[model samples]
Target chain A: MAKRSFLIPGVDKRLLIKDSLKAMPDFTRRRFIAGGASLGALTLLTGCDVVDSSSAETLLAQVSKFNDAVQAFIFNPDALAPTFPESAITKPFPFNAYYDLDDAPDIDGKDWKLEVRGLVDNKKSWTLDELYKLPQVNQITRHICVEGWSAIGSWTGTPLRDFLKLIGADTRAKYVWFQCADKDGYNSPLDMRSALHPQTQMTFKYASEILPRAYGFPMKIRVPTKLGFKNPKYVVSMEVTNDYKGGYWEDQGYNSFSGS
Target chain B: MASLTVTDEQVGVTPAKVIQPVWVRVMHWINALAMILMILSGWQIYNASPLFGFRFPREYALGGWLGGGLLWHFAAMWLLMINGLAYLVTGFATGRFRKKLLPITPSGVLHDVRAALTFKLGHDDLTVYNYVQRLLYAGIIVVGVLIVLSGLGMWKPVQLYYLVMLFGDYPTARYVHFFCMAAICAFLVIHVLLALLVPKSLRAMIIGR
Candidate 1:
């Protein structure tokens, strides 16, 4: 006698159903499928239509946006990333960038001015000295890379929230975009909540020394809560805007709001 | 429930009751799918830096690239967490934990180990889980919790400092998470092997017989 397959057929149909449900734009499907939906129910919802790869990608992107909204909604403005003791800082911190250390841009600090653009009352650029004059603070925090390694480093700079306030930027803006001085025009954007986090800094120094060329000579935004890539180095300009200006990696399908 | 019990009068075998419920089987397969995707995508992500000397092969890894792997990892992470949580809650609330998994003793575990090592373990009765099965199930539950906590620590080490501290540090937490994943993979190997050897067990899990 031939052996009978029991659950395999059902499992395959269920997977197809799940795929169709995921492709649907309606949020009600989630609620309806809360306790798990049957194949008949899924077919009824999607009309048994096949979702192509492009449609699947679009659905996935929508899901990612939904995740971002949920994360932003739950984020606490006052909550701080953990700060470590000075001794805990990783020595000889590994240099990470899209390019080699030798390729790091040699910016002329004396001639350079931090450009302020977009929705800000004051459009005045700041010299390195002027940025240094802002109330400075220090933090020993971990820099978690997207790739699996992590390192602790001591960073010092002006609080980004204070700087935004001083610049008379609209705090209600959706994103604070960074334009890097790197050769590739590498950049990233931060949501309002992460932008205003206490540890988010317009960093100017590392381990009591002036920010080295390898670590963004003029300035870097130290956002501890986000993955390392979100902390765009070699930052030359900043823009406060409601428009969705995607980042370098973000445009390549990496999550825009990469907050932990 | 009574109809599910089976006895062989001619062979003089005792009656065996159905062990897996429909919900248990559903949770089992969902968890299996989530774990498989997570492990595969996690390997793809690990290949980005590699704590060890070598990296996982592209063909063997899921998601194709680092960005794609991250998307898969984060997506499946929610599935694993939510499904695992529901399984835990249901297991405890429905008394499945107390009735089927708990009350394990050192002596009972020792006896089961001896029985297993000596090849004296029997599968004639499928109603009750053996001491070893019970212990392994409990151990996997503990490891699952550790994996989630360590993953959280790695995900938001700064925000979830206490979880990071639980495993000594961030690096340590990463190592813990990796090893837990390895442990689960090992369990899966043994589980599938045993299921093949005892085909009825597979049928029970699938059909809740």
Candidate 2:
């Protein structure tokens, strides 16, 4: 019929007078049905303030885990992430972290030790000078972040595969878990295949200069293939193990194998 | 029971032709569902680092946040890819693609464009796809394929380096994916309007009567 006000049966009639402003039911019914379903599904996924074992959060987590396995299977270690020319380097490379810049862990180079543990023949920790001396190489590669931004930065360091070999790390292990000095204990697990990538490095310098405090000083594992978060910074200890220890963001629903 | 027993052909009555076969109808509904999930979740993912300036409203987004958006996107991606592959394979194997969307000519499209603009386009014959429908249906197929490729390129720039290279780079591939989504949304508006304008076509898609 025509645009006009209508009443609900009884209890809800007074509360819904604003509904009279809407278009004809024939026009708006389908839109409402579709929007309602979407809103319903959104609430289903997020409305539960408490995430338990049997929740949709767990279901999505399981899918993320499945994605990790798919990524591992599809990962070709020989296929390298494209490297850029020196000129292509993103000037003043963006500094990204869960916390603000001034709060980045401040550590003295004189006191820091790269602790090595688990499934490695060499349990000895290495000093910053010792890591700096390991046959160095440089690469300008794109750093892709999960937030959908990317930057190219030149990093100089020894390949993680070579360093792992030098440290006598067991290659059979599934992951190289890095524990960082960030106040929130920000950490990440590096998959073995990615850890062995030719370009993956335990970086010591940025743009031929000593790594700065703002850019994870002491060291940052530069993984070009994976999303930025997978590249843990200010790493203090590493354990080569079969265990899948959840990470800072990974535990909060981010996919563990966030590589591209 | 007698009505069911008596054949339409034997009784000198024309049979109701099935314009969309059972498989096509099944796959069409599935594709429609998957497309909605993908587009909604993708909007949220794009909002994370939008290429252009404006953002899709949060209420319109499917997932609650970035992480949730990605989960929904990846989940729907698998469904879309599988269903899409099945559509292509069966369509090609059965010559359905050739029958429905072939012989598309520039002149025919222009004529249809003129007819559509002036609101003179006819939908009396549901079985014979008009030139506009053929062109749109065919063009959307190509767009669908490119969007998936670009999505893959963005997803695995390293493992699929060669694929990403075809689109120039990661950010460029993101642009292609975004434009493809835009094209699909455009098509959806027209497609839905036509279905509404010709309600019998919508009935055929649903009940296949």
lDDT of each: 0.83, 0.85
Error of 1 at A216 (Å): 0.7
Point out where model 1 deviates above 4 Å.
A1-56, B1-16
Error of 2 at B60 (Å): 2.0
TM-score of candidate 2 against the unseen true structure? 0.84
Q: Which window of ten consecutive residues has the lowest lDDT sum in model 2 chain B?
A: B1-10
Output DockQ, candidate 2: 0.18
For each candidate, give its TM-score against the true structure.
0.85, 0.84
Real contacts recovered, all predictions: 0.44, 0.46
Residue A195 displacement in candidate 1 (angstroms): 1.9
DockQ of every predicted complex:
0.31, 0.18
> Across residues B78-112, which tens digit of lDDT does each residue of candidate 1 receive?
77898899999999999999998878999999999
> Which residue pairs come into collision in candidate 1?
none
